[model samples]
Target: MAGRGEMPMRPARPGPPMQYRGPPPMARARVEPIDREKTCPLLLRVFTKVGGHHQNEEFAVRGKEPKDEVQIYTWKDATLRELTDLVKEVALAARKRNARLSFAFVYPDKHGRFVVKEVGSTFSYGHGRGDDAKSLAELGFQIGDYLSVAIY
Candidate 1:
């Protein structure tokens, strides 16, 4: 028996040296450097609240996790009317059949308080009322804003 305190004797000859069968494994993918000058488009987190007939079904499937209920979307070069349309489209796609959908754009004021504004169903051809005429960039919204959707 070999003891831990002493080295054990072995055969004087060593087995054949192991040889690699193929070329060296491929190198790992290189990480691309980020461009600091480039900035991301204004993005908003949306939380959908299910209601009416499909409310039970949606809740059953999605549970109550906020991450499962939230969606992130980018709105760039979009007017208020266009943004409303996009939000409506998303709501329609996500809601149950025959469900009515509404949008609320949630933003913060200069005092760091949140303000929610309801989006109208109809869209005007030209520039809209108030901040509707301005592009997203003109609205002074940075990335990571939020918009909540209500399904009825």
Candidate 2:
């Protein structure tokens, strides 16, 4: 104890040295590869329009969907580029040299109302703007969801 105006000093405590652990386990986890041979393909309902995408109001009512429909049996691992090639097979407008294809997912919301959400886009005959590598699973595609393609 100090008798005057001097301050008291405390003893120092020792602790273990800090170590740098890399990224967390979840961050380093890898996605398992899916086997297409044994897995059955899902039926994907697609609608196409030459100019622009179909409005959400068009799909508001049941049995009133757009007239042009294409059914595709594909896996969830399918990329946008693969889907674009498949669309070109049936959609003549999408086969143009400089045509553009915009993709959107149509699904029912919490209130059972249909909603249209644009996912990605790709070019017809040339290199895409990076969206070509995005897979259906990466775009939050569901089994019952419908795909709408706008050809421009």
Q: Model 2 over residues 1-152: C-alpha lDDT tens digits?
A: 76588888766667877788987665422335669999899999999999999998889988888899999999988989999999999999999988999999999999998899999999997775649988898888888999999999
**Model 1 over residues 39-118: C-alpha lDDT tens digits?**
45454666665552212222222234244244545554455556545555555543344444455555555766565555
Which residue ranges in model 1 land beyond 4 Å of their true spot?
Answer: 1-40, 52-69, 77-93, 121-144
**Among all windows of ten consecutive residues in candidate 2, which has the lowest summed lDDT?**
24-33
Q: Count the backbone clashes (under 3 Å) in each candidate.
A: 0, 0
lDDT of each: 0.49, 0.90
For candidate 2, give the lDDT of residue 85. 96
Instruction: For each candidate, give its TM-score against the true structure.
Output: 0.38, 0.77
Worst 10 residues of 1 by lDDT: 52-61
